[model samples]
Target: MSTTLILLILCSVMLSSIAQIVLKTGMSNPGVLNAVQSGVAMQMITTISTNLYVIGGLTLYFASAAVWLLVLARVDVSFAYPFVGLGFVVTMLLAFFINGEVLSTAKVIGTLCIALGVAIMAQG
Candidate 1:
């Protein structure tokens, strides 16, 4: 693949990963957590819908999808889709650093496997 294609795919994947973190941050807010724990659907909807982080995350996700469309137009889905798995690695790292989430041994192993698979697939 061309350098532009590679960068575009990576950009989409990173944006998606960052969006998940942003959404998680929004949801982890105490008020959002309380709304969720309350089990009132309307409260949950209201809290989430009005959250700036959630809105920004969705916007980022939309941007990622737009970039992904460009990727799809240029390459085979089979060739491009595996790259999405890279988001797992990206998300894990972001979670670990940004959210202070634990990075278990299993997660490390799984992410390594995914990275290896993407590398192998890219060679085809």
Candidate 2:
């Protein structure tokens, strides 16, 4: 891939990672689901609306969509799809670190396999 394409892919991956983090933060709020369950969907909506992290996450999600569109304009779908694997790797790491989620040996091996597959595809 050309440098421009590589940069675009990196930006998309980073933006996607940031979006996940922000969404996680928004979800971390203790009363988030309770507000929804209490028939306070509007209040939940308002809460998310005022939350900088959630708003930033939403913005980054849209921005990533736009960037991905631009990337598709310049690259083949085959190439672009592999780039999404980077997002998967990032999300897995974030889940482990940010959410205190456990990564079993089996899961680690699976993720390594995915990374290897993506790497092979990128090399090809």
Checking candidate 1 for backbone clashes, the offending pairs are none
Candidate 2: tens digits of C-alpha lDDT, residues 25-75: 886776665665667778988776877778888999999988988898998
Which tens-of-lDDT digit does each residue in 23-93 have in candidate 1?
A: 99999999999999999999999998999999999999999999999999999999999999999999999
Top-scoring candidate (TM-score): 1
Quality of model 1 by C-alpha lDDT: 0.97
Q: Which candidate number would show the highest lDDT if scored against the true structure?
A: 1
Model 2 poorest 10 in a row by lDDT: 29-38
Off by more than 4 A, model 1: none
TM-score against truth, every candidate? 0.97, 0.85
lDDT of each: 0.97, 0.83
